[model samples]
Target chain A: MRLWRWIVCLMPGLLSAGEWSGYAELQGRYFPQDAAYENQSDHLISLAFQPEYYQRWDKGNQSLLVVPFFRWDSEDKERTHADIRELIWTYAGNRWEAQAGIGKVFWGVTEALHLVDTINQTDLVENPDGEQKLGQPLIKLSLERDWGILDFYTLIGFRERTFPGEEGRLRSHPPVDQDHAEYESDREERHLDFALRWSHYIGDWDIGLAHFNGTSRDPLFIPRISNRGEIKLMPYYEQMRQTSLDLQATKGDWLWKLEAIHRSIDSGSYNAATGGFEYTLVGIADTDMDLGLLGEYLYDDRGDEATTPFQNDIFVGFRLTANDVDGSELLAGVIKDMDESSWMFNLEASRRIGSDWKTSAQIRLWSDIAEQDPLYSMRRDDYAELTLTRFF
Target chain B: MKLSLILATLLLTPAVTLAMTAEERGLEIAKEVDSRDTGFHDFKASMTMLLKNRHGEESLRDMRNQTLEVEGDGDKTLVVFDEPRDVKGTALLSFSHKVGDDDQWLYLPALKRVKRIASRNKSGPFMGSEFAYEDISSQEVEKYTYKFIEESEHDGIASYLVERYPVDPNSGYTRQQMWVDKARYIPIKIDYYDRKNVLLKTLVFRGYQQYLDQYWRADEMFMENHQTGKSTLLTWKQYDFRSGLTDADFNKNSLKRAR
Candidate 1:
């Protein structure tokens, strides 16, 4: 009953619009490995529910948008969680408008590896791993003119960490004494990040550009320390600077997309008790580059997501789509016993069923080019997965 | 062997006959609707377009246009913009055939060039409305497989509910359900779908009038979105047909010559 009440409160925005709308989905998967231990197969089931509510007043000049979401994974001990995905209050006047509160701000168009879907789950790039380490409270502002649109935002009071001691204890290992010591005194960290984005359309092309700077939650730490000498501190002091460029073009049935991203990171210095080595990870000491391409062929059909029939018309007969999904080739030159370069490729093809359901087969390959070199050879693995998705 | 052959023929005859009857009825209705659409030689109408976003805010614009064309089989239409000078003198030519594919061209005075609009994009929104390029294109009986669903009344007019499935794979709409007036065969209502077979939108027609005795035109059309709380209203005026339009006027080279 307590869980139900919490879910209801978290979803006030969903019913506020006085309309009832929601969707539920379930997915299952199987894995196989060459080695018995590595090849051990497992099954996972997950459910995601979203409810949306909205109200518009003053002839749309002022409005409220709310969406609350919930999820449960059978594989994760049947743990259930709820979150307010979007809660935004908007005010629009003539040429300028502003929206504040917690909501998703998607900045990039790259489908597979979005540099800007950074609202939540910074560590889990493709799937949610039950960790709420991502997402920050932010304030957003925008200005719209006849020519284009400009947007700005700042995120504050951000902290996420993982302690090594708790994980070690969970695995029946010794807990870190330093982590337990830190937990006795409540230690809190804060961060502030800012970004500017611009978007405009010219003829058949839509273009976007953005730049952002801020501290990224330490990817290697946990935020809380347990009383049992478990240290949960996400490595902080690491900062990142990022820039992106995007372009999309549509002609006839063909839609083309191209995007590029450049990121520089400064990994802060930390004390290593195990090795008794004091290390300072420089900021912007390493650079990462990403390039992506996407293409889709749209067929003519009634523009609805439902009530369309299964037909083999030219537009609906068959469709082919391919993306470099997450083709990020990372190059780290001689840094802390880590010098390697890796790349990934993914491709898919699907057949349209009416307008709501589609079945697709996908193949993925991952490889490390410097695997043979002693300086950089710890990265080489390939996996493939096929999925049939239905959209409404 | 002889007995089995005879039995096989006897069993297949009824099933084939039933299938043919349904298809034949659908084709007949399509032809009837197409024929009734004939006769407007030329037309001009003043219109106002209203757009309402999800927030319930409304944006209104005025539009005036003139259309000249014929009906049935192969027909050519010339559309001229009168208001919104930015789009004024922009001429749209549609060459529709009874079978096979249709051709379209747009002449932009600013660009001083005639551009061919591809038919593959016929499923997309037309002028950002629920109506797709395929919906506005000429409807030839052979291009679809139709099924008569039922009989109903709309705005006091007796109508037949018909389902039309596109034969062209490139069409955006997999299937469309239409309400055609019994007397005039003009589509009074239509439901559209996307490739995923989801209900995307609906269009309602009102205020029907006869032009040049044989042509029936709907003065008002309202399109509403199912997912997004958006709607578009189009009011057409001055619909004309057959102002001595010839093949020369529809030629790619003649796009600039169109006045």
Candidate 2:
């Protein structure tokens, strides 16, 4: 409480010196069905605040940005957490830029899945979409030339992915025991990582090629019997190397995107790809609204044996943009398993309330999940969430 | 004396016919407008857009724009949003071309991703304003076929009226009528006709200022839709030219760094 008071007092003075902006959000989630796990709440409320401070010096070539995020969840203790999303310093030169400290970088072009965006760890407790990320400590250098833009990264400290608690609504029957985590590398969590990427655009085609060697961000779970006569799933992180390619071509009203990755581990190697296209019809029905039709196919060579559930799946989505003063938008998508009859449906809608406020609604549902499917554990955890955010 | 006068008249007629045609004259005027504003290497400006609905309700949007001039091609532009707090750090990068479609990319700050978007929707409203994407994009002489209509006076200023037809099939307008300031070679007013050859909108530019003693820019632009009764008022401020901006400042990396 004292620390919070001190921060509140210092915020005004800091704003007078630099540029400051952020958002505070109130979120409510409703689960109309019963929880899949024991002790899980049917309804929950959460609050989050993210504040960002930025300052530029040396003729806008050098700058510092700091963002801190905090969230409080009513029922899920693991969901209540704090993180420094970004605290980075950047310097730009004639044809090169260097950045250091904690940051986030995204590298994929597909919509359904992000196969090549491996820079940051996923904050899974935040959302099921996997769009939220935890900042990663890194030192990055980028060089721009006639050929292309090349970036080199040295990732230092590593952060493990967050999972829901036992009492969390969206959890497996047997919760993961993060305390008993194992690592394939001798350095464990301290293992350093390196990555490089080259990206460029020619005509309407944009291409990116990247490589990463590091401790895998995705962990495999191993069921173990505890000494207390309890069964728990222990996470095991392996060392892996990945090569990925992302490509996009924009032609008239059509945008084509493709992302593919080949990851190699001590055990073996596997390949996965997600490719899709979005075709838009502008000024539909004699109005200002635009409709976009999207279709993407997700494939994993390992098929049902893959760790992720996206093996042999097809995703189809529709996006509507009102192009109105309120910036109204909506997206509905469904992912269907080709091997099984499992399906996951998602709907997201958002609109600006006023100049400084916004409201968004999201609904996620899983239906007819097969017992052997990885998503079968929480098939009954279908829920809808609404969030209202105020920015300052 | 009558024979000599006839000979002289015949010779003068040929000279007048060879001087220039209407299409050539219009093209020359368009070139003049483009050339007069050529030497401004780069510029930065803050802009505000006021959108008025048919019911008289208004919404405001603020953004900052930076443009870099390319010698042979169209200009490179970067627009960063500021007022819409939800999209505060979002930025758009465009590389306008003299022919074909322009290349555009949008950067989302929350996801830290740059997405290449289709630029074929030139007729769609820009930021839900009455202005379309083509209405505000960089104008190049090659995009339209021109014909000089008449020399007239608009708002007490001597101007040249020109009718230009769009060359692109995707353009929403069949043709546009423009009134170019005779002295400054800058467009003072424009009337847009829809694909069906109906009057769609009228745009008026005001508050012209000279920069570098060679370039003229409008501080305010008003666009009104004739059928919808909705309007958009665009006001620009802090126009700084020759700010030492380079090509590197208009790339994908630059889009992410725009704040």
lDDT at position A357, candidate 1: 40
TM-score of 2: 0.95
Query: Which pairs in model 2 have colliding backbones?
Result: none
Candidate 2: tens digits of C-alpha lDDT, residues B1-259: 9999999999898687458788887888899999998889999999999999899998989999999988899889999999889989899999999999999999999999999999999999988899999999999899999999999999999999999998989898999999999999999999999988999999999999999888898999999999899999999999999998998998888898998
Model 2, position B231: C-alpha lDDT score = 98
For residues A2-107, could you state the per-residue lDDT of candidate 2 as single tens digits? 9999568445544557788999999999999987777899999999999999987667787789999999999999999999999998888888899998999999
Which one wins on lDDT? 2
Query: Which ranges of candidate 2 are over 4 A from the true structure?
Result: A1-16, B1-20
Estimate every model's Cα lDDT from 0 to 1: 0.50, 0.92
Can you give the lDDT of residue A284 in candidate 1? 20
lDDT per residue, candidate 1, B33-69, as tens digits?
8767655555555666676778876645454444445
DockQ, all models: 0.05, 0.79
Give the interface-residue alpha carbon RMSD of model 2: 0.7
Q: Provide the lowest-lDDT 10-residue window in model 2 chain B.
A: B13-22
Residue runs of model 1 more than 4 Å from their true location after superposition: A1-17, A34-41, A77-81, A116-136, A159-189, A217-237, A251-256, A262-264, A267-392, B1-120, B123-132, B136-259
